[model samples]
Target chain A: MLSIQVIADVWDRHLITMRTIEHLHMFSIALILSIIIGVSVGVFIYMKPKTANPVLNFLNIVETIPDLALIVLLLPILKLGAGPTIAACVLYSILPIARNTYTGLKSVDEQYTYVAQAIGLSPREALMKVRIPMSLPLIAGGIRIALVFCMGVVTLGGLVAAGGLGTVLQNGIQLYQKDAILVAGLWTGLLAVLLDGFAGMIEKKLHERYGTW
Target chain B: MQTERLFDRIESIQFKGITKKYGEGFAVKELDLEIIGGELLILIGPSGSGKTTTLRMINRMIEQDEGSVTINGIDTKDADPVRLRRNIGYVIQNIGLFPHMTIRENIGLVPKIEKQNKKDIEERVKTLLDFVSLPPEMFMNRYPKQLSGGQQQRVGLARAMAMDPPLFLMDEPFGALDPILRKQLQKEFLKIKNEINRTIVFVTHDIEEALVLGDRIAIMDQGELVQVGPPEELIFNPANELVADIVDNQRKFKHMDTLKVKDLMSPFEDKYVLEAKMEACDAVDEMTDRDLETAFVFEGDELLGQVEIVDLMKCRDRGEKLSELAKPIKTFQPMDSVAFALSEMKNSGEYLAIVMNSKHPVGILVSDEVLLKLI
Candidate 1:
């Protein structure tokens, strides 16, 4: 087993604590932007169903691009540091959130909408009152998925001088320090798992409230 | 905000040459129907016969291709569809109570949208629950899924009645119920209809339910109106073979099941009635003259059981009074179906049943009379 002092020494040498804060900061920004844009796109496609296929296909293509390749492509436009990393994370995350929202909105039992109309709910009211509430569990599920993707991408931010846990791992590889690589890698994974676990709890809460069906 | 027009009442709805088509086939074709205000008119037909389509047109759920649906002589096309719908109470087979909302929240949605006072809405919701015979205290806070199917349906009715719309459009609202529950709800619905003065357009495929609930029924076939009349007219003077067959085929076989003991009961003949103090010979003479196997013994309008002619003859030698020889008889409520009375008679080994209404004997049903009515 690795000694506690050795692990603490490695943690201090690369400033892993500051790197984690930077990783989380980038992750939050990217995730928030992804949620806003993804949900808007989902609602747009739902309202105009004809565009759903094209838009989702385009997002799928963005998702297929390797993470580093996406960052490299964005660097010319968004520059290095946290900007390209955040942009790449958002680009990767939008598909899952948008697709889930679209599916959720579409899958609401058709009867609820008919009832809404019969009860004199305008089209907007029907969407706001019935459709949105019914779709929440699914949207929350998508956000959970997006959360995992953001955590992974934000860790990779350090490779491009974005200052996250990924930078410590890069330093360990380049300098051939086994302690730095092992400790930073484990910590990054633990952070991602913790955040994902938090998101899962939120999803469970939303499911309880809105997935009574 | 523009003030939304409020329709205080709708007295009549007239469909003039209204048509709706899906692809090549017509859902409803050139249908003309006049619904008088405040009557429960049942639109009945086999499935796909356009009864539902016609009902939806009144509220503009399914818009007609041609012609106007005029409510109280105002063309529905001229009114905003949303504003028009708020004035119509609607119910469907699925009940359509929102799953996420509690019973109170579901019922109060429309009132909130219309900006009604909160206290008034709560009061109205309470009265509406009472109208459907559901006590608010127990059910008001429950969610839709928490209630049984029957309870959910009652909440559905409470929601529709919350609008207090002058016209109600119901499409097979009780079609999902089991037979026993359906009959009970039908009776309860009739009581509710009596309590409210409003027009109703009910759609159903079940002919028996239509006959039971309709003030007048309109039959549809292949997207065409076959006939429209009161249940008596359709049963007695059918305009065509299809109409005749509708009344004959469906109504006759299930007549015993649909008919109540009250419909077949006859008032006990005066000659066959005996006083409790009358001598056995006098009771025998009254029953014998009318050929009545049993005679009711009454002491000043109170039924004191019944005396059989055989028992009367046997007790004559002892000079026993009618009350002394009288045997207790089974009593059935008037609402009990004739079929129920027959099955009950078979089980109990008795053929005579006193039809009681509120503990007061109104009439008697004999096996022979029940058989005659069935035939």
Candidate 2:
């Protein structure tokens, strides 16, 4: 019978604690970087609305490229390390964040913008004060989606010799260590659920604070 | 009273041959108009008739392709558009109070943008809420979505009046409201306007609203001003078939021509009389003695229109003499149509009309008595 003791034994031997820390590190760095790049690009596209469809289409095409293929493609340029893995994860995260941000900003009531202008707010001021604040729930939603995407992609970083819980699962499978694989799989899922729940809490708080979606 | 002093500083807005075109079509053709300070000029027309376009030009929301729009003799183009807009208040039909901001913040926005003192902004916000008849304590903390349409519109108006700008531009400000609410807001707006004395350019497609609120009405058609005059002039002497047609709809239902002064006239009474040179207290005593509602002032053989006891009371309140309260007479022949007399009475805001027969006054036509006869 597969037991908890056996799972603990596998976790201790495989340095599961270090792998979990590496997984969280990769996910968080990629998420932060993705948010900065994605949000900025989204805002830029919103300002130059004519560019939105083209930019989003390009990002959509980038998203269609398999995650493994993207990691492989980046390997030659970035080499086998955390760098390429984080880059791949960031690339994977961009589509949801940028698309949601663009859609959110674009969908704000046109009357609010008109009133902002009529009240003499400069375009920049209006965007910052009215548009951005109103679009918060959606922007936060995008960030949450990107965080979830990062969690999954960070696990896949193991394929490129990048350190994370995926390495444990891969090694256990090769060695026929069922307990090791099960333990790693269980922790990875737990981490994903935990991070997702945290993101959900943030989105909820933002919706409550702004009182809007 | 403080608003009166602020009002006197505003100069008239002049549109000198201003023209705006969108591609091959003109939204507003070469237009020349002078909107007097502190007056409510209503621009009215059918859809796509350039009433909105003309109003937008005043604040340079839609730039004029030719000529210039000058506020207080200063060309709008010369002033920074943003700065110029900051100084002018604007309201729209949508009541665009920012949904994210509380009602207080929405109303205080202009003052905040203008960098007024924080305490002063709070005080002004409270004052404006009261002015619009919204209690600050009840509404200040609430978001716009929580308010009803009428309340949101009141907040919109309060927001526009936040900085107390001498000029206000409204583009169908109350067009979205139900008819009952529209009428109530219109009456309230008239009261507010009387107190503030701001130069207002109001846009509306409803002819009835135009007549009810405009100090002067400007009718537009095909991007051109068809006629501009007081509501009475527009009703009695329309510039063309279109203006006549607009008035005719209301005139037909009113049965205006069929009414005559003789049908509504009341017999002249001796008790309702006072000499032109009578003392103020004596006039009041005479009215009190007979329990008369009005007293006609006489100078020798000539008859002047009657002054209501209400006017005497108002004179007392203002510490003015009885002679100051003797309004000039509006005399109509007994054969004159009731519509004509009614129009005169509406224009003058007097309830009593003198019905004269060639040489002397024969009777009085009280609006209430006339209305009763109609029923």
lDDT of each: 0.82, 0.79
In model 1, residue pairs whose N, Cα or C atoms come closer than 3 Å (at least 3 residues apart or on different chains), thus clashing, are none
Best by the lDDT measure = 1
lDDT of 2 by residue, B84-146 (tens): 777778999864888888998998876786677889999999999888876677679988877
Compared with the true structure, model 2 gives a TM-score of 0.75
Question: Candidate 1 lDDT, tens digit per residue, B180-265?
Answer: 34654675687788888788899987776787788999999889999998887887788898877776673544465577888767
What ranges in model 2 sit over 4 Å off?
A1-4, A7-12, A201-213, B1-9, B113-119, B252-375
| Residues A82-185, model 2: lDDT tens digits | 88889988897888889888988988988788778887777887898789888888989999888877887788888888899989988988999888888899
lDDT for predicted candidate 2 compared with the true structure: 0.79
Per-residue lDDT, model 2, residue A33, is: 97
| Ten contiguous residues minimizing lDDT sum, candidate 2 chain A | A204-213
